[model samples]
Target chain A: MKDILTIIFRLTVACLLAGLVMGTVFIATDKAKKHNVHVNEQKVMLSLLGYSAKNPAPASVAMHEVYRYLVGEGEALAMGYLLPLRDGSFSFVTIDLAGGFVAQNPVTLAAEKAGEAEARTAAIAVALGADKPLRYADQTIVVTDGGKRTAYLLPGKFPGFKTFIGAILAIDPDFSILGLEIMEHEEDPGLGAEIDQEYFKNQFKGKPLETVKKLEVVKTPLPEEYLKALEAEKSGLGAAEVASIQKQYQDKDIYALTGATISSRSVTNGVKAMVKKFAYRLAILDRVLAEQHIATPF
Target chain B: MATDKTNLQLVVNGILNENPIFRLVLSMCPAVGISTTVMNGFMLGIAVLFVQVCSSCTIALFKNVIHPRIRIPTYTLTIATWVTVIDMVLAAYLPEAYAKMGIFIKLIVAFAIITMRLEMFASKESVNASFWDGIGMGLGFMFGMMALGFVRELLGMGTLLGYDVLGFKPLLFFVLPLAGFFCVGLMMAFFNYIEIVYKRAKRA
Candidate 1:
């Protein structure tokens, strides 16, 4: 009885000591942890925007000025605070350009509105079974400075990959492609990484929706006869006009990565789907801008 | 085993003969996990050194009063307390290192080396002896981690402690976990070869 009592006494003392020490440590470090997280979020945002500098600012003046200039200043939305998923594995942050506050943990907000968006897209796809079914998130933030409205979608996954792909599609409110940015990819470093280069992504820019649908990587250039046919259809063109117009239909001569043809095709198809879905919205945004008498450099 | 050996001998033993990874093979959980980079290995080593020395001394000082039946649990709680303290310190002052180490910092509690040394040596040894043993073992663990990290960073990333080395063109395969296993395995073999030669010389 005495031995058992002594064991219990020892265990109790050890447990109490351990709890007291751990509690003190947790209390001491809580503030620092929060500060580190804030700084890390800023760094991640800068990297996503393709800034490669190690420290964002010098040690002399305030760093907040730099952050404001780079990421823009506004009240951070409460809902934008990234929360750990139920499984405690991954977290996501959402930036709302239109609402002027970045919203974190958009997965929860997305889940809330998924039903309506799903129904609408499903109805549209079902009606046009001939056209491919493309899924797009609702409540995306559209950034508009003057006349141009640019919508930035969050990085999302495509089929046949375990990791998410980061892509940004910029459309000129008139349903024409202005630019495209693929920030990062994990497909195959050198081979698949080529998708981010201007040579590949530039094909989409300045292309209208109707003309973009016929885009394909062809080996042989289009014959002179096809050019003659296209030119003859639209007459009364000056020398400079003919040259510029002829340059527009030049083949989108994208060379596929040697062994990574599938990955290359995946990005190409992803671009097409994104353009097709946003074309109508781009037109609507253009109409809105025109009505407001905004002059945008498209 | 020489009782008359000086502090320098103890240091050498910690780094070579009594290496916590290759020789003793304790505290491998963090050794393997945080050994991908020199910075991570160095920080983890410091953290482990602090915990091992403090906990060993505490355990040795209180060895007389602790009941045998609940001794293991008592040692665990004591080690856990030290780990939490170290974790908090890292988070507060060394936030970058803490963020990089991430979940491994918390897992320091489960490192077998701390509890093993406490139960096997510290509980029966003098306070001074336990302290030195902790230092030696901690240094050994640190050295092993750093060695693994150096190879990985240099070969895999073509950088040493994040500095560009060999003109920055690196073999990507070395940065992955599989390369870590191979590097450590080859290093252990090299250590074993040295040990064999030393043992033969001593016998002669």
Candidate 2:
């Protein structure tokens, strides 16, 4: 009994020491880690829009962050978009469950608080001047080029083979997919993880929002011609040939990775759902903005 | 009790006679999984090296006070603490590498190579000796991983650290899990053969 007690005591001491050490490290590195993640995410957004270190995004390019929130509960539920106005302030535009404009309220939320969902929600609750339960849903970035909207960079997440796969989808003004950049995933390497490869991810490029809404994953092997076209930049194919190939398979289903059907299907379904929902929300937002004569930078 | 070996011997033993991957046959899982690319192998090796050294030194320092019956748990706690610290540091400073080696870094806590060294050497040795052993073992593991990565990436994808060396893939089979095992087996045989031949030549 005494031996058992001693063992337990020793184990507890070790646990305490481990807890203390980990806590200190977490506190020390938390801010830096968050900053790094934010920087990497910004880089991804720029790259997805065809900007890179070598060919930097133009000085006229502007990225406006828009936050989405699920407001209220049950029957009183509504969707709110915290939009940036042309004058550099913010407004919370609320739409009812039936896609009707409900209310618009000017809200003040610090830019740094964007990473903290609770803080954003609290700020929104105060602005709403109501007891409605609010939950921050997701964020979309509007990329503009000198007062002209270029692309919508939407962040999305869905379950992959192992865990959730986080990705950023860039869409043009007409809702055509500009590119897909996989940010995070735990899918098996050389199999499911191939989704991040250029050939696989670039397949989504040029796909319109309408086609993406019905996109499906086919188990058929990706054709040699199609694969070559998908890798046009590397294979040195002319822009005309790339466009022809894309047009040829524009309506066809996404070809699943060789042995990663689940992963392929997950991405296809996730992209479809995200694009469809975003289109609906944007339509409502546009209607509400027009009726209220409120000019948003987005 | 195993601390009789000189510092140099401990390191040499880890890299050659008692290689964690080839001779000791420890940590085969990661050695096979992440060794598909040389960069990945090197990154994982660095993370493992940091954790192993920290855990071994911590264990050696506290061995006297830790109860013998509960030593395993204490060693595990030390390893987990160090692994978390390294994981956080990597994510903060080297986000690119962290993204590539996300879950694998956390899995380091369960590596048998670490626990085995802590049990067989660190728990018995002086703090200074254990520290050297950890270095030796860490470097040996890193060497093994890089060697496997070098072979696998070259043959599997005809690339060396993402550069196209051969211009065409030599064998796609080498990139698969089966090929990983085959490469490990072949390398193991090659190491053993060299050892046998070296011993015979020395005797002559």
Candidate 3:
């Protein structure tokens, strides 16, 4: 009995001592570690935005510069009006006054609307800097200076071999892809890591979203009609012919990775979904811009 | 088991005779986890060496006062404390290595080999003997892990550390955890073959 008690007592003391030492060490190093994490997060964000700097200068300086260059001198109202959803959610629906793309966050709206109406309203109130809870029908406008071209934030799910990989696909108003930034993935490195490469991502850029309707993985050389349509579209002279031309080439196939069929298909489907979602939003944006008499450069 | 052994014998024993991974087959978790890259294996090995040496000395000194029933837990606490210290120092000085090692550094607490040595040998032996034993065992673990890491990194990624040795056409399958099974299997078989030949020669 005495021996057992002694063992327990010794173990408890040892554990306490170990905890104290570890706690002290962690506390001493917490500041430096937090700074590293902050820096790394900024680096990932910059990479997603296609900024090629290997290492950003510093958080305060780099973030300020990025905001200045991207946001420009325009105040929040100059960007566009905020749309409150039925669930009391809000979006910064901006059409670029400059001749570029527009940006919208559909996921953010969907996330806010995911519960009871009252809960969602409460969440929105917190998000929008309001002390009192607002109803879904309330007309509350929060303003911000929107400078960058608006890209439709499409939810992307690529193939990860083990599971469906999720990402955020940013697309331009004309249905062309702006970027495919991976938000989450469980893919193996050197193989799935290839998805993050610029070459693969660049292929989706400038391609019409409608191309994903009948997506197929084929060899690189598309059919002759598709090539002709592409040339005609590039020339911009055959506007009348573009509809039929696009329809015929719509069923055309795209090249897939040699051995990685699942990964290829996932990317193809992910792109398709983004295109479909963006196409719907583009129509809405076009109507809103025309109705509001907003002069869009695009 | 050699009592009157010189320093060279102790080193040789660590490298060959009583290798922590192949012979004792201890601390298999970190050995496999950090063995994905040569640099990771090297860094982890050095860290383990420091912890083992320091913990062994401390445990051996306190062996007299520590009750027999609580010896295991006491040893574990000492090892855990040392590992936490090593983890902090690495995080401060070598952030890159710290990131690469990831959760494996914290896992050093559960590395059975360190605690096993402390309880089995260090607690019973003199401080000097325990110190040498710790060094020997730590080196043995390091050798095994490094060997596994070298082969895996070379074959899997076509690189040593992060350098592209061959033209960077990596065998992607080799980077996955499944690849570790094949590597350890082949190495074990090779060791067994060598052992068989050595036994046959001794009999002859």
Candidate 3: pairs in clash? A76-A144, A76-A145, A101-A150, A102-A150, A102-A151, A103-A150, A103-A151, A218-A254
Candidates in order have lDDT scores of 0.61, 0.88, 0.63
Ranking by lDDT: 2, 3, 1
Candidates, DockQ: 0.54, 0.81, 0.45
- TM-score of B-chain for each predicted structure, in order: 0.86, 0.95, 0.86
Question: Residues A156-273, candidate 1, lDDT per residue (tens digit)?
Answer: 3454232556665555445555556664466664566666654455555556666666555543443544344334434444656544644664434334545556666676667677
TM-score for chain A as predicted in candidate 2: 0.94
TM-score of chain B, candidate 3?
0.86
Which lDDT tens digits does candidate 3 get at residues B146-171? 88998889988899878989867567
- Cα-lDDT of candidate 2: 0.88
lDDT string for model 3 (A137-192, tens) is: 21211111243343444444655667877665655546555556664565555565
Per-residue lDDT tens digits of candidate 2, residues A84-177? 8887677898888898888889878776675577777777888997678787889998899998989999998988889999999999989999
lDDT for B96 in candidate 3 is 81
Ranked by DockQ, the better of candidates 1 and 3 is 1
Model 3 TM-score? 0.53
Could you give candidate 1's per-residue lDDT for residues B18-48 as a string of tens digits? Answer: 7888878776656665688888788778777
Docking class of 2: high
